[model samples]
Target: MSDEIAVPPRQDNQQWLRWIQAQYGGPACIRRGKRLHDALAQLEQSLARFRQPGHDDDWLAMVRIRLGQLHALAGDWSKLEPLLDADSLRIVQQLYTDLQPQLRLPPAPDPRPDVLRTALQELQEAIAFFNRRWLRHLQSLDLSFYERLIADYNRYYLLEKECLLQSPRLARLGFQPLPSLTWQSLLGRFPLLPMPRLRNETSEH
Candidate 1:
């Protein structure tokens, strides 16, 4: 993806794009961890651009707010620091306050009106990030974090589901719940036992 975000003047979309690109691998190499890292990096660039000179205040505010959310989704704690830092706390606090309403909306309708397939892939990547990592964090957090994380996940998941439901192109896809209980059963049976790897059958002979 291009690093140019096409934001208003003094908006270093290029810089933001560069930072974001730094987090992910080339198109062929993009994986879950790399995607998460790239998302956070993009978000941070959005945050940094807000403080740069000549940027539109309203646009910057919106971008940073969304960036916070993207950061939250990607588990980018480092990006949160600016918001929590004593000097920037007020800005951070207001960002969250403003973000609450925006979060309620469905995600930007898959940008590709012509190609629903690409949009489906985008949604899958977005959801897979939560299923693999963020959801686990949500399930394990202390009361406070759990509440916040689950709410975020719920909103995101519902939005994705809504899009899928509306898309006639995606009618063939079926929902498959992940196996969460299997790991626990294995742990219960083995306690401290190390998992064994399968050996090659031919090697045994």
Candidate 2:
């Protein structure tokens, strides 16, 4: 986006980072993305195409309409970063540190059947503990509003993209809808604490 429409970078605590989208960067409401501007420009072309030749279908009309709606949705978007509640990440990070293997080697499957079974049982308990702890942290976040916008974008982005490209095929290629910001998807941002992997011994032939 040009500096004319550009929003200044915001100052927040070090815990927050911007959402990543390689194709268009952040939301247009925040950065006024280049693709969004291009999409808006297509409205005139769609109107012009409707007036010419044998274009009786509503395809172009919907494309224009979606573009406008998508733009409006984006404009309503404020800084969605810091999307995560403050302190959530820090606590999760500390949890991860506490779960680290530290200097000790991870448990290995033992040759004795009883020892192997005990190790496996302990590992399962640790796995359950990690999952329960992680779930508690994830459930505490409030993603209802941002996720609603993501839901809206998933519904309309492709149609608006078709407007920008002027070709449905072009719009469909390499297109991936933004996922709703669920706790599961948020895992990509905040990682899970994991128990050490069991390294089973292999016999050399």
Candidate No. with top lDDT: 2
User: What are the models' TM-scores?
Assistant: 0.17, 0.32
Query: Can you tell me which runs of candidate 1 are displaced by over 4 Å?
Result: 1-158, 168-172, 178-191, 194-205
Which whole-number lDDT from 0 to 100 does residue 193 have in model 2?
38
* Model 1 / residue 132 / CA error / Å: 28
lDDT of 1: 0.37
Instruction: Please report, as a residue range, the 10-residue window in candidate 2 with the lowest summed lDDT.
Output: 76-85
The residue-by-residue lDDT of candidate 1 on 32-74, one tens digit each, is: 3244445445544643453343466322333334434443443
Instruction: Please report the TM-score between candidate 1 and the true structure.
Output: 0.17
lDDT, residue 30, candidate 1: 27
Residue 126, model 1: Cα distance from true site in angstroms: 43
Output candidate 2 Cα RMSD. Answer: 26.0
